[model samples]
Target: MVVFFDSLQGVLVILVMIVIGYILARSRWFSPSSSQIIARIVTQIALPMYMIDTITKDFTKQQLAQLLPNLKYPVISMMILFGLSVAIARLLHVRKNRRGLFQSMFFNSNTVFVGLPINMALFGPSSLPYVLVYYMANTTFFWTLGTYLIQRDGEGTWKFDIFTTLKKVFSPPLFGFMIGVVLVLLDVKIPTFIASDLHYMGALTIPLSMIFIGIAIEKAGLRNIKLSRYSLGVLAGRFILAPILMSLLLWRADVPQLMKQVFILQSAMPVMTNAPVVAKLYGADADYAAIMVTESTILSLIAVPILMTLLQK
Candidate 1:
């Protein structure tokens, strides 16, 4: 019971930030364009800084080596989940218009925005490296295969572009992570003043991220979210099967307890917040994607506390 309450306390911290964003958005403080701005700042500026700061300061070479091998756990889990999502989509006869988005959402996750904070809340700062390991896999897959499927849902055909795929895959956050890793491997030292700057800038990542999510939910309009076979399918994929698959993969593996917990928690995160944007860009069902983003994010609040309780046990 104490563990459950402690876990709930962590979730409550997240809920409060979300609510602030929701309220401020309702007041029209955040324009529709604001989600884009906040996302850019977080992903491009704040998140990268966070990575550089954490990696250069907090992580050790030994920890980095161990973290790299464990990347297989998330990558393999996502691949299996992708296959299963395809099966479920077929079984349900999901419409071609939104089917690609459905499967994409099922297999991918909001690793940075929702997953990061929740893990931080539940497990504290130590969970950051494990969360980043999962993020690397999630981001690469999303930019390549994930976006391709989203494009498939559009009116036009999607031709594969290696350069474009590579650009997106090696995104700013990932690049920041890469730079940090290199710095660590070379055993280089960051100047004290610059390190302080990185710390201040990186601090914006979480609160702003939560606020962006709230604004996104507000923009999507909660009333528009309803469970269809498609939404339910996505729900099952995210909240149920994803974690189970991750757990199975990690079951016999020798790894740190924190890594296992972060992996499982990340596996159950909501649909990638980028889903609707990519859908809109591709001329697919952006509204459907937006609704699922809202729906799954809302449900994850409920799901996290429950899962955390079980994990605490």
Candidate 2:
């Protein structure tokens, strides 16, 4: 219990950074548009750099062989949990109009935006391969499998173009993933000067993303909106219940300690921000998606730290 509390201290520092961003956003020191630019920069530029740097520096055949036996545990664990979360959202009786948004909420997480930094900070360079694997697992699943469930039976009166959705898989960050893999495969050597510059740029991704999250929350007016029990229920499922249940199952399955921690931590993360984007595109409840992302994000400060403390022990 004492160790748990001490580990919670690390989580608190991260929460404080988010709170500072929120305060700045509410004060109008930064506009939502600018905050979005920060997110875009991070997502399009900084995050990809981080991914490239991590992957290019570390991947090797021997490491792959060692991780082969355990790789399925974390990746499959996430797929199952994502599935269960969506099933619960469907079961909750959210109105038909809102169901797609709610389902997307459960279908995705803020892993790339938030999870990367936390993993890097807490576990250091040692967890880079797991991070890469997690990225591949989550993004592949989201663009392909996750999209089908969201658009398959919707009332949008629109054609569900799997091709267009598949195009999203080649997003800038993902393209970076491909480039990173190529560099690793060819054993491309980055010079000291260029590598150092990219590393410096990559460092800004998480903090900038957090600021964007704050600005998004302020613009969305989550605090002023009336909370439905249903919304709260969804948030509870994402932030509170899901991680605990999933972590236990993975632990019992004898997954590696680092991968177990990564899975649990990612599960504890807030609902994905781009969920609203997907909702709007698919003619779902964009407003509800915005609300879920905001509320879950705020609550995750409490939820993640508590869950981290519990699991780390």
Candidate 3:
């Protein structure tokens, strides 16, 4: 009981920042380009620095080794979710235009934007390597299979660009992580000045990420949201199904408790923020994707605290 409230308090701390962004976006304080600007700064700039700072500082070679294998858990979990997404899509009789997009959004999560900040707030920097591991698995799958499926929805044929897929997979943050890992393996240490700069720049990740979510919500329009079988099905996949499946997969695994907790929490995050962009780019229903993002992101505030309490027990 107390645990739940404590978790709620942590989420509320995050909510305050999100509310600030929501207000700013609503009041026209944030321009149309604000979300894109913030996202680029967070992903291309802030997140990579954060990855380097945490990975280089907090993780040792042995610890990184232990963490790498755990990636398989999230990969396996997502694969199961992917299969279930197909089954649920057919069961729901989702439209052909939106069916592939539906399955993509159902299985992929907002791992970096939502997952990182919440994990840091709940578990601190020590949870980072585990978080990165999950991010690696989640990002790879989302870019490759997830994006391909979404593209298929738009094109209605087997269409995949390996060059584009590879570019997405080996993203800036992953490059940062790889650099950190290489330095660790090579026994190289960053100079004090450079490390300090990275730390300062990395500090922007959390608050900016939360604000991005807020902007996304505003862009999606709260009035536009409506409950339907499709939304309900996605809600089930994210809030209920994903976490439960993660728990089952991790139940008997030999790993750190924090790893288990972080994995479970991350598994159930909102639909990917990139969903709408991909849907729109590929000529699918961007509005539907946007609604799913808004719906899942809003519900995750409630879901996170509840999931936290369960993780505590």
Candidate 4:
């Protein structure tokens, strides 16, 4: 019961942020262009800083060394999840333009925006190291293969450019992750003033992301959100299939109890808020992505708590 309420509280906090964004949008204080600008700020500045701050603050040389060996769990788990998502998307005969969106919805999650805060809330600061491990895997694949899936589906082309693909894989967020890891490994300390500045910037990631999502929802029109078979499938993939699969994969893993719980909880997160942003940038079905993100986020209020309760048992 406690687990359920904690999960519910965390989700409600995020939903409230979204509601605030919606109200602002309707009042003309926030526009579509403002949403885009916020998204840019998040992706380019806020997210990277958050990544660096969180990773450095939470991890140490001995801790990271301990985590290095277990890195295989998340990496392998993500690969399997991506493969399953691709297979399911094809089985559903998801259209070409939306296939990328489908795959991303099924596999990647709102790890930065939703997963981080919720993990902290549910499991406390102790969960940060495990969260960072999962973040490393999630961020890497989302930017690499995940980007490819979305881009190919959006463009309906198979033209593979090695240089372009490589470029996309090493994104700004990933760069931050690498830098943070290097600093940790070298036992280097960031200047206290600089770290404080980065932390302040990092704090903007969650509210800004949720607000951006609310702007997307406002643009999509709440009344217009009809749950198509495709949308239903995405919901199942994100909320149902994902948790089940992750549980089965992690059930036998030799890890701490909290680590397993964090992995499962993260797998059950709502669709990535950035799905629409990525779709729009890559010429995919941005509207479809927006709808999935909005619907899944709303549904997560119920889904996350239930999953948390069951997983706790």
Which of 1 and 2 is ahead in lDDT? Answer: 1
CA lDDT, every model vs. true structure: 0.91, 0.69, 0.91, 0.78
TM-scores for all candidates: the values are: 0.98, 0.85, 0.97, 0.87
Candidate numbers, best lDDT first, in rank order = 1, 3, 4, 2
Candidate 2 residue runs with Cα over 4 Å from true position: 58-61, 64-71, 78-87, 145-155, 225-227, 252-255
User: Model 4 over residues 205-295: C-alpha lDDT tens digits?
Assistant: 7788878777877887888779887898888878887778878887888878888888887777888776777788778888888888878
Cα RMSD (Å) between model 4 and the true structure?
Answer: 2.6
Candidate 2: worst-modelled 10 consecutive residues by lDDT: 147-156
* After superposition, candidate 3 runs with Cα above 4 Å error: 155-158
> Regarding lDDT, does 2 or 3 come out ahead?
3
Instruction: Please identify which of the two predictions, 2 or 4, would achieve the higher lDDT against the true structure.
Output: 4
List all candidate RMSDs to the true structure: 1.0, 3.0, 1.1, 2.6
Per-residue lDDT of model 2, residues 1-313, tens digit only: 6655655675565666676777888788985368668877998899888767766776764654465466565466566666776667667777666655565566466777667666665677667666666666666666666555455435556455677766776677777767777776677898988788778887787788767776777777865556786677667667766676666678677556877787777766777777776666666666777777788777776676577677765
Model 3 has a clash total of: 0
How many residue-pair clashes does candidate 1 contain?
Answer: 0
lDDT of 3: 0.91
Give the per-residue lDDT of model 1 (tens digit) for 1-313. 7877887898889989999999999999976688899999999999999999989988888878888888899999999989998999999999887788888999999999999999988887789889999998998899888998899999888988999888888889888888898899899999999999999999999999999999998999989988999999999999999998998898888898889899999999999999899999999999999999999999999898888778766
Task: For residues 41-145, write the lDDT of model 3, one tens digit per residue.
Answer: 999999999988998898888988787878899999999999999999999999988888889888888889999998998889999888888899999998988
